[model samples]
Target: MMRLTRRTEYGLMALAWLARAGGRFHSVREITENLDVPRRLLAEILKDLSQAGLVEAVRGPGGGYRLREDPGRLTLGRIVNVLEGPTIFAECYQGDCDLSPRCTIKRGIGEVARRLEAVLEDFTLEEVVHGPAGAPAPSPSS
Candidate 1:
């Protein structure tokens, strides 16, 4: 039962909304009201996005958040990494678990995580938000 966490879902939703804003900043209140999301949660999510360089934050009056990364080039994998850190098998993959000595799927779990990241990288924000007609997202520069 693999699925996106609430934070990733809300973060992705906020990004799509901001991308559609055509570069104009949108306050957390505005996004929360429009998307029916929790204000405090959204603010924290937005702060994480801002710190990750995905969105730029303008402080004070007449200020809010605007998309900074080019949506056309941004990959879902990158977003997930920023919001949730690297996808991995965690302790099991690191051989720190009690069953690491006999875990049959430990190696397989690492492979699954890598494949998942690659699949996610195949699509861009534009493709995900709009449609899948565009070419694959360019290879990550770094």
Candidate 2:
């Protein structure tokens, strides 16, 4: 069963929180408090996002983190890739398959991976923050 890692989930949560802030900086403490995420993990996730150029880290008294690009322009796939690396959600495709030499299901797994990517590609950060509507309200309750 494929699933989003805790790190990716935290990254998305942090992104949506920042998105709701409307370009304002929010500290890790604030984000974790609002989302009930762990401080250490959330900090690492934010650092990864900052290094990936999705969010900018500000330095000063009010310094924190801000989105580098429009939330709408950022894709879920991009975020996942940044936090988790290129994911197939399966070890087989990552060259960890011990049955590769005799496996007959590789082709089907590849197809499944492609379909998953296609679906993920359709979802943008904006959709994650605001849903399908142009603007409503951010839901970081998750």
Tens-digit per-residue lDDT, 7-118, candidate 1: 9899998887777665577799888777888889989999998999999999888789998878989999888888888766456766566765777777678777677668
Those runs of model 1 whose alpha carbons end farther than 4 Å from true positions after fitting are 95-97, 134-142
Off by over 4 Å in 2: 89-98, 132-135, 138-142
Per-model clash counts, in order, read 0, 0
lDDT of 2 by residue, 81-134 (tens): 898888755666666788668887766787788889878888998898876667
Per-prediction TM-score to the true structure, in the order listed: 0.82, 0.84
The TM-score between candidate 1 and the true structure equals: 0.82
List per-prediction Cα lDDT, in the order shown: 0.80, 0.83
Clashing pairs in 1: none
